[model samples]
Target: MTAKAKYQEVLDLGASLNIQNGDVKEENGTLKVWGTANTPYEKNLIWDKIKAIGGESPSDIMADIKVADNSVYHRHTVKSGETLGKIAIQYYGKASKYQDIFKANSDILKNPDVIHPDQELIIPNA
Candidate 1:
């Protein structure tokens, strides 16, 4: 599979897990999850298993908040000859929005200018 396709596959697997419930309450322009699962140990175990398989946490798992849906969030892998700007334009329709792509994927991208093959990146909608 292509690096981009592989990255998306990993994201699809992560979205399959019962991780986050999209019940965020908006207050003063801030969206917050209303409730949390009581059994943290059970939740942690689930999270650990997901992590062991190269999946990333959707949000702060420890926080008393529901999980958010990230299915529409595109995951891109850096291939040779790919640039952050190119990715931004390809996904968001604007090269200047590369910063948005970079910010959404800070976990995987240490430097915007430098990305390697197989490194997954989140592509946020504009």
Candidate 2:
């Protein structure tokens, strides 16, 4: 497969993430991709996708993904029936780290257990 076709899923992921200034080009046998992500989490997601498809350090692709926000790991919108533990697990891979998430969102969250849908919570860099 052509380099571009081989990484089509990565391009699609970038589009779905609403990457800014996205550009894609295939030169020789390498795919070059550039874009700006809203947060480190999003940027990592792109790299993870690329690595998943191309291996850990594939020479077939070169991506210069930038992060627009470095203050927080991610800004997550709460969904119904989602708890801090769940969000923590999704981001930190440990449910017990919910306290950190609660503390980071203390301004908006009066209680750790109380969160409503649509509330934007900061997933602090942990």
Q: Which candidate is the best by lDDT?
A: 2
Q: Please, what are the lDDT tens digits per residue for candidate 2 over residues 1-126? A: 999999999999999999999999889999999989999999989999999999999999999999999999999999999999999999999999999999998999999989999999999997
Task: Provide the clashing-pair count of each candidate structure.
Answer: 2, 0
What global local distance difference test value does model 1 have? 0.54
**Stretches of model 1 off by over 4 angstroms after superposition:** 1-72
Q: Compared to the true structure, candidate 1 yields what TM-score? A: 0.43
**Candidate 2, residue 95: how far the Cα is off, in Å:** 0.6
In model 1, pairs of residues that clash are 20-67, 21-67
